[model samples]
Target: MVDDDDLILEVAQMSLEVVGGWEVTTANGARDGLVRARAEHPDAIVLDVMMPGMDGPTAAQALKADPETADIPIVLLTAKVQSADRDRFADLPVAGVLAKPFDPMRLPAELGSLLGWT
Candidate 1:
């Protein structure tokens, strides 16, 4: 998982670990996320959209562009709720998008559903 916010990363990791029984690794920004993804080859990546430096879609594009991590499904988590905010991601290849302030209790299920992990 990748997000700039420490609290969000902690919450997401805790939620997924407890609720989904999954192991998680986190990155604070997109550049690290991309590098980590390539190295770890995780089952799926849950990325935050508004991160500094490389933003989620750009990172996702980079991951998709690379041969190593190209097939990993990416699910975006964003605070972008407006049509305009959301439309910016329409052209990206993402498994799904989940709104921010997401219920921590529901996050695991959401991730499982979005990535077909369940």
Candidate 2:
């Protein structure tokens, strides 16, 4: 997971781990997320849209550009629920978008559905 907010990171991590029963790792921002993603090679990445240093789409571009990280599925986490903002994300080759303030209990279902994971 990648998000600048500590609370959000913590909540998301717990949601994915506890409710989803999945192994979870976290990065504070986009740059670290890239470095860590390269090293860990997670099956999927949950990235925040607005962050310092590098935003989610920018980081996703870098990941898509690199052969090493290209295959991993990326799901954007965004507060921008407006149709225009959602349309913007649709242009990117991302798996899906999760609205901000997502429900912890529903995270697993949301992620699973997006990645087509049973």
Off by over 4 Å in 1: none
- The TM-score values for the models, in the order shown, are 0.95, 0.98
User: Model 2, 73: alpha-carbon shift in Å?
Assistant: 0.2
Per-candidate count of clashing residue pairs (backbone under 3 Å): 0, 0
* Distance from true location, Cα of 113 in model 1, Å: 0.9
Give the distance in Å from residue 27's predicted Cα in candidate 1 to where it truly belongs.
Answer: 0.7
lDDT for 17 in candidate 2 is 91
- Those runs of model 2 whose alpha carbons end farther than 4 Å from true positions after fitting are none
Write candidate 2's Cα lDDT for 1-118 as tens digits. Answer: 9999999999999999999999999999999999999999999999999999899999999999999999999999999989999999998879999998899999989999999997
7-118 per-residue lDDT for model 1 (tens digits) = 9999999998988789999999999998899899999999899988889989999999999999999999999878997787888999999999999889999889888867
lDDT of 2 at 51: 99
lDDT of 1: 0.91
Worst 10 contiguous positions by lDDT, candidate 2:
92-101
